[model samples]
Target: MKNVEPKVPLAVAGSSGFLPGCEGMRGAAALGVLLTHVAFQTGSVTESFWGRVWGRFDLAVALFFALSGFLLWRQHARAARGLSASPSTGRYLRHRIVRIMPAYIVVVCAVLLLLHEARGASATVWWANLTLMQVFVPYSLVEGLTQMWSLSVELAFYLLLPLFGWGLWRLRGEAARWRVPVIVTIAVLSLAWKYIPVPTADGVHHDNWLPGYLSWFAAGMILAEFATAPPPRMVRLARIPMLMPIVAVCAIGIAASPLAGPPGLVDLEPLEYAVKILCGAVMGYALLAPIVLAEPGRHHRILASPTALMLGRWSYALFLWHVAVLMVTFPILGVPQFSGYMFPVLVLTVVLSVAVASVSYALVEEPARRALLRWETARAERYRRQNGNAETATAATVTKASA
Candidate 1:
C-alpha cells in the first residue's frame, strides 16, 4: 500500500489529541483477547493450525499494553520536551480512576453476586478483586473474572506512570536524546525481573504482574518518543511498501513457533519466556506503528471507520464483560467447558458480550466518566478563580500602602 505522512505530525497531535486509528486498534485487540479466551474454553487451542493461531491471540494483550503506553505517555513526552505541560498528578490519577474503576467495580460485583461459581467467594477475594489486587494474592481470582489479571497489571502501570513520567521529565537538557534509552533500560529490567526468583504462594503467577509485561508497554512508549520527532530512518521505514504488515506477519509467525513456548497453561522455560516477550513487543509495535507514524491509507481508513470507532468506544466494557459472558454461554449452550462447540459458542458469546458491553458503556461507563471529568474541571476552574481574586486583592493592598 502507498504510505502518506500523517496530516498532523504526531508531535503536535501528541500534545492533546489522539493518534488516528487508535480506537480501531483498541477494538481489534479487545476482540482478539475475547477470541483467545473462547478458544481455550472450547478446547480449540489445541485442535488445529488455526486453533494454535487463535491461542497465540493472547498477544493482543501486548497490543493493549502498548496502546496504553503510547497514548498515556505522549503528553508526558511532550511535556518533557517543553512543548506542553502534563496534567497535574492528582488530575491524572483521578482521570484514570474514573476511567477504569467504576466499570470494573460494577463488573466485579455483578460477577461475584450473580455467578454461581463465585457466590461463595471469601471476603478477601472480594476485597482483592475490587481493588485490582487479585493478581498479587494467590488463588484469589474468582470465576468469570479470571481475565482481570491483565487489568490488574494495567492498573499497576497507571499508578506508576506519573513517577515514570517525572523521571523522564527530569532528563531536561538530555531529554530528547535519552528518552528512548531510559525507557529501553526499564523494559530490559522488566524482562530481567522475569528471571529473578520471587517466592509466591502456590497458584500465583508472577507473569500476571506489571513487571513481566512492562517491555510490551515500553515498546509503545518508545514509539511515542519516536513519533514525536520521527527520525529520518523511521520515516523512511514507515514509507516502505507493506513493511509493517510484513513485520506483523513475521512476528506472529515467530511467536507461534516453539521458541515462544507452548500455547497453554504450561510453564515456560526462561528462554521461551524471553522469546515470547520479545515477540509480543515486536508484534505490538508492528501493528501500532503504522497508524501512529505513517500516513493515512486504506488500512488506517478502515480502522478509523465509524463502526470501528464505535467498537473502540465500547472496548473496555466489552473486555470487562466478555469472560463473564463466556462463562454463562457454556451453560446456555448446554456445552460443557472444553467439549468443542467452538464456533457456535464463540458467535453467541460475541453477540451477548457486545450487547452487554453496549449497555454498560451507555448506562454506566460514559455517564460516570463524563460526570466526574466535568466536576473535576469545574473544581479546577473555581480554584483558579479563587486564587486569581486573592492575588488581585493582594496587589491592590500593596498599591494602596505604597501610595
Candidate 2:
C-alpha cells in the first residue's frame, strides 16, 4: 500500500505521537464524568433542564472508549507498517502498565486505607483491583472508585489490539477488505450479546462487561482507519467542516431523547438499552471525529487550547481519584444530605481532586513511565550489541576459512 498524501494537515502533524486536540477532548470527557457524579451527589442533577443534560453525561465513558480504540489502533497500525520502533508485544504491555498502574494503585490504596471506603471487602477484592481484573472478579470494585471498571475494559482492549492488528495486517489479496467487515460483525454480535439474560445477584444487569461496550470501541477503530489510511470518500467528507457539528447535534439529541434513554438512565429494558448503546456510540463518534479528522486548527478550536491539554494530561488521575476525593470531602464539611453547602462542597471537591491528581501525575505516573521506557531502551541496546558481536565473529571465521 503506497502512502496517500492527506488532503489536509492532520492532528498528527506538529506533534510526533500525541494527537493535538485530543487532550482537550479527554479532559472534557473526564470533567463530564465528574459533573455527572457531582450532580447526583449534590441532589441537583434531576431537578432542572440543565441538570438533566448533565445527568446524561455518563455517555462520556463511551467517548473515552472510542478515544482509546482510535489512538491504540493508530499505534498498532503504525507498528504493522514497520513505521514505529516499539512494536514488540512486551514493549507495548510495559508502556500500558507503567502509564496506567502507578496512579491507579495510589488511588486504590487511598480508598482502601485512608478513606476506609471499602472497609468490608476481603483481601481478594484488593488483589483483583490491583491486577486490573475487577470487572471479571465479581464484587471487586473499589468502594468509591467504581469508575475504575472502565479501566478493566480498557485493559482488555489493550490486550486484544495486537492480535487484532496482526490478524488484519496478514490479510492478502481478496481477503484484505474483509477485515473491516469482520470487525463490524464483531460489533454487531456484541450488541446482540447484550440482550442475553445473565444471572446476577442484583436484578439489574451490569453492562460494564467488554462485550456490551465493544461497539463504541469498534466505532473508534473505524475512525482510526480513516485517520491513518482514509478512502477517497472519507477524505472528502472530512474536509467538510459543517458535517461533523451537524451530525453531533443530531446524534446527541437522539441519544438524549426518550426513545434512546432518559436522564440518569441506568437500568433499561434490554431492547431500550441496546438502542441507547447504538445512539451513544454514534454520538461518541460525532464528538471525536471532528477533533481527529478535521483540518488542523480549524475544527474543535476551543479543545485545541493549552489549558484543556494540561487538564487532559492529568485527566486519568482526575478520573481515578475524584470519587475518593468526594467521599472524604463530604464528611469533613459536616453536611450529610443536600443542603446550602452543596455548592461549596462541589467546588471544594473539584479543587481537591485536581490538586491530588496533579501531584499523583507529577510524582508517580510520569516518573514510572520514563523509568520503564529508559530500561526498555537500555535492554534493547544490549541485545543489539550481543547480536552484532555474534555476527562479526561469524564473518571473521568465514574469512579465515576462505584464506
Candidate 3:
C-alpha cells in the first residue's frame, strides 16, 4: 500500500478537491437519519410497509461508518506513501477534535440550557457527553440527543484507528492479500457478538457498543483497499453504470420487506437479524461505490448537484442538531401524531435543522477547524526552522575543528 499511489480517488480525496458525489451521499444519509427519528417520534408510519422502509433508515449509521473507514484509511495510506508527513497522535487527535467538538459542545450546552426542565440537570450526564463517553453510561446515552450514541461509537473508532492502521501496515505479500477477508471475518464476528444475549440493564443492549459496528468500519476499509490499489476486476465492476443503483434498491427493498420490518422496527429472529445486518452492510457499499469509484464529475448528477454539495458540507452539523430541531419543532408547530400535520412538521423540522446547522458550520465548526489547523502548521514550521538552524550551527563547528 505504501509503495504506490492510489489508482482511484478515495472517498472525499483530501484537500486537492472534494468528492462532490460523496458529499451528496453523506447529506442523503444524514437526511435519512433525520427522517427515521421523525418516524419514530410520530406514530405516523410504524406499521405501514413504506413506514418500515423509512424506519430502516437506521442503516445510515452503516454508511457513516463505511465513509469514515474509507476516508480515514485513505488519509493514513497517503501519509504512509510519503505524499504527506505522518501526523503525530496529538496532532491527529487535535484535528479530529476540532472537526467535531466545537459544534458539538455548542449544541450540547444549548440543548441543556433550553431543555433543562425536560432533561434532568445531572452534572455527570454533562460530563459524559463533554468527554464523548456517553455510551458507557445508560442515562447519558439518550440524554441530550438519542442519536449522539453513534457519535460516541465513532469516537471509539477514532481512538482505535491508528493501531488498526499499524496492524494492516505490518502485513506483507500473501498476508496483505488476505486483508479483505480478515476484515470481513472480523465484521462477521462483530455481528455475531450481538446475538450472544448477555445480561444487561433493562433497555440497554449491545447495539450501543463499538464491537457491534466494527464490521461496518471493516467494510469501508475493504473499499479503501480496492480504491487505493484498484484490482482490474474490481475497477471494471465499479464502472458498470447500473450495478450500484440496482444493488442499492434491492438492498433497501429487502430491508423494508416484512422479513426485516413488520412493525417498523428490526425485531427479527437471530438468523434474520444476521441477514438484516449483512444486507445493510451490502447496501452501504453499493450506495458508496459509485460515489467513490466513478470518474470525477461523471457520476449521478443529483449527488453532485449544487444543493447536494451545500447540504453535504453542513451534514455533520445537521446530524448533531436534527434531533434538537425535532424537539423544538413539535411544540412550536403543534404537530399531532398520525395526522396530516406530520408532513408539514417534517418539512419544518428539516428547514430549521438545516438553517441552524448552516449557521453553526460557518460560525463555529469551520472557523475553529481552520484556526486549529493554522496553529498546527505554524508550530511545525517553527520546529523545522529551529532544527535547520541547529544543523547549520553544528556543521560550522565541525568545519572549524577540521580546519
Output the number of the TM-score-best candidate: 1
Best by lDDT, which number? Answer: 1
Residue 241, model 3, lDDT: 82
lDDT tens per residue, model 2, 13-71: 21125665778889988888887777677676563566666666777888899888887
- Candidate 2, position 130, lDDT: 84
lDDT of each residue in 268-335, candidate 1, tens digit only:
87777888888888888888877777653324667888888888999999999999999999989888
Cα TM-score per model: 0.93, 0.87, 0.89
Candidate 2 at 299: error in angstroms?
7.3
Give the lowest summed-lDDT range of ten residues in model 2. Answer: 8-17
Give lDDT per model, in order.
0.85, 0.74, 0.76
Of 1 and 2, which scores higher on TM-score?
1
Task: Give candidate 1's error at residue 316 in angstroms.
Answer: 0.3
Q: Which ten residues in a row have the lowest lDDT in candidate 1?
A: 8-17
Candidates 1 and 3: which is better by lDDT?
A: 1
Candidate rank order under TM-score: 1, 3, 2
> Among all windows of ten consecutive residues in candidate 3, which has the lowest summed lDDT?
8-17
Off by over 4 Å in 1: 1-16, 296-299
| lDDT (Cα) of model 1 | 0.85
lDDT assessment of candidate 3? 0.76
